[model samples]
Each structure stands twice: as structure tokens, then as C-alpha cells.
Target: MIELKREGDVFVLRMDAGENRFHPDFLAAANEALTEVERAEGPKALVTTGAGKFYSNGLDLEWLGAHQEEFVPYLESVNALYARFLELPAPTVAAVNGHAFAGGAMLALAQDFAVMRTDRGYFCLPEVDLGMSFTPGMSALIQGRLTAPVAHEAMLTGRRYAAEQAREAGIVQRTADEAGVLPAAVELAASLAGKDGGTVRAIRVGLYKHVIAALRGPALPE
Candidate 1:
């Protein structure tokens, strides 16, 4: 289950389901929560985190296996979700409380900044190992967010980066103890909460136009 609550000037979106995979229902809940965040008035920012030992495990492969026919549309929705985050009016932060793999890593990449847990967890994109290739939008998001060398290394090697490693690679902006992840992320979000939402949106939309177009366009390359 996902929960959305306000903490001072920040909205915390907590993904509490085990593994927090992208099941259809999970996507629906996330979208609804983001809608509420978008509609809120005045100074605000957002922080996304997960419970237990997982930020998210990415797509629900078992669910996908049972619903193969829906693959295209499902991916389209996933792409749209990434686009939404890119265009979200408020500044956003990802509190990587634990492991973030594949799509989960992309979700964190969507944020303006990320704070990862220091002693545990990893940031990895293991699509190659899983014999899967990224959807077009996913590729765009990753490449857009990361430096050329880092993106190439991460996508090609499927390396598992610990918090400090990820920070050095520029995958996460900060690292904190497990217990401090959320607090640090919230503090970061709150610090940027006073920026005008519309201006933030405008700048992001303008700066990431190509990335947003790729995200909002086709999930797969034509």
C-alpha cells in the first residue's frame, strides 16, 4: 500500500508494499497520490520513499507473466508516470531507504535529488542480466539523468552500487545512515519548498523537453 501525508512544507509519498513493484494497482495509487500533490496550494515539495529493505524491486515479473498481452500498454503507463515526475510542479527528492533496482532506480532518477541509505541497500539496473532491454522511454530517462560515462557503465555492466559508490558516481546526491534517509530527504525537499511551483515546472518542462517528449511519446521505439 502507498500512503501520502504532509510534513510541514513537504509531501511524503511512502511506498509500503513489500518490494513495491509496479503492479497495475500500485501504479494507480501512485498516480492518485501525485494528482493530490499537484493540486495542493502554496509552497510545497515532495519526498518519495519505501518501507523495510526495498525502495522498490521494479516491475512485477510474475504479474507480467500472467498478463503478457497487456505489456505494451503497461509500459506506456510506466513511461507516462516517469513523465509526470519530470514535469511535476514541486521540487522532489527520493529517500532511498533500501535497495532500488531497475524501474525503481528510474523512479529515483526522476526526482530532483536522492538521499540513499549508507550501510545497506544498493542502486542497480539489472535489465541485461535479466535478459530484458529498457523501453525507449526508460533509456531516455536514464541517459538524461546520468552523465554519459556513468549511464553507459550502469546500463552496460548492471553493477550494484552501494550508497557511497552511487554518490561518487552521481547517482544520488547524498548518503545517510538507514535511520536518517527519510529525515535527510525531507530536509532537502523542505529547503526547496519555497520556490514558486509554476516557475519550477516551467523551468523543468523547458529544460527537459526532449526527455519529456520521449517519455510521453512511445514506450517502444517505432
Candidate 2:
């Protein structure tokens, strides 16, 4: 479950305890929350975080394994969500309170800023290790967000980056102790909450045009 709460002008989205993997239900819930945020009035920004030991462990692989035929549609939905975040009309932040792996890491990347827990937790893209390749959209999203060398290392080596390492590599903008992650993210979002939504959306769309195009493009075959 994804819980949506309001704190001043910022909306905090708390992912459920456990791995917070992207099962279809979880995706639907998140999208619904996003919809509500988008529709609501007043100054607004968004901060996404998770409970327990994992910010998110990524895809629901077990479900995917049993429902092989759904792969294409599932990835399409995932790409749509990423694209949506890229074009969201307000500032966004990811408060990575715990481990963020695979698609979870990608989710964080989709945000405008990331604040991660420094005492522990890791951010990694394990696609190569898992014997999977990045989809074109995923590749574009990562490449667009990170510098050439950082993106290369992360995608090719499947490195697990600790908070400080991630900040140095520009993967995350800030690091905090576990308890401070969400607050830091919320603070960042709150600071940027009053920007004109139309202007923000337009600028983001123009800046990430190629990435959004790739994400909204056709999904690769399984």
C-alpha cells in the first residue's frame, strides 16, 4: 500500500512496509495517489519514501515469473509511471530510507531530487547481475539523469552505492541519517513548492523530451 499524507505544501507518499515491490496493485495505488496530488489545489510538491528496511526492492519478480505473458504490459505501465514523474508539475523528491534496487532505484532517479539514508541502505541497479538488459526507455532515463561515467559504471558493473558514494556520483543530492531522510526530502520539496506548476511542467518536458519520448515509446519484446 502507498499512503499519502499532507505536510504544509508537500505531499508525502509512504510506501508500505516490506520490499514495496511494484506489483500491479502497488502500481495502481501509487498512480491513484499521484492523480489525487495532481488534482488537488494549492502549492504542492511530492516526497516519496518507504517504511521498514527497504525503500523498495523493485519489480515483483515472483509475480512476473508466474505470469510471464504480462511482461510487456507490465513494463509499459512501469515506463508510463517513470514518464509521469519526469513531467510532474511540481518539484519531487525521493527519500530513500532504505535499500533501493533495480526499478526502485529507477523510481528514485525519476524524481527531481533524492535524499538517502547515510547510516545504511544502498542504491543499485542489478539488471546485469540478474541476466536482464535495460529496456530502451530505462536506459534513456538513467543516462539522462546521470553523468556519462557514473551511468556507465552503474549500468555495466551493477555497483551498489552507499549514500555518500551516491552523493559523490550525483545519484543523490543529499544524505541523512535514517530518521532524517524523509524530513530532509520534505524540506527540500517544501522549499520549492510555490513554483508555477505550468512553468515547471513545461520546463521539465522540454528538458527531458528525449527521455520522455523513449519512455512512452513501444515496449521491447520479452
TM-scores of the candidates in the order shown: 0.99, 0.98
- After superposing candidate 2, which stretches have Cα over 4 Å from the reference? none
lDDT of 1 by residue, 31-66 (tens): 999999999999999999999999998898889999
lDDT of 2 by residue, 1-222 (tens): 899999999999999948999999999999998888888788999999999779998889998999999998898889999999988888899999999999999999999999999988999999999999877899999999999999999999999999999999999999999889999999999999999776888999999999999899877933
- The collision pairs in model 1 are none
Candidate 1 CA-lDDT value: 0.94
- Alpha-carbon local distance difference test for all models: 0.94, 0.93
Which residues of candidate 1, in runs, are more than 4 Å off? none
Most accurate candidate by TM-score: 1
lDDT for model 2, on a 0 to 1 scale?
0.93
Q: List the residue pairs that clash in candidate 2.
A: none
Poorest lDDT segment (10 consecutive residues) of candidate 1? 212-221
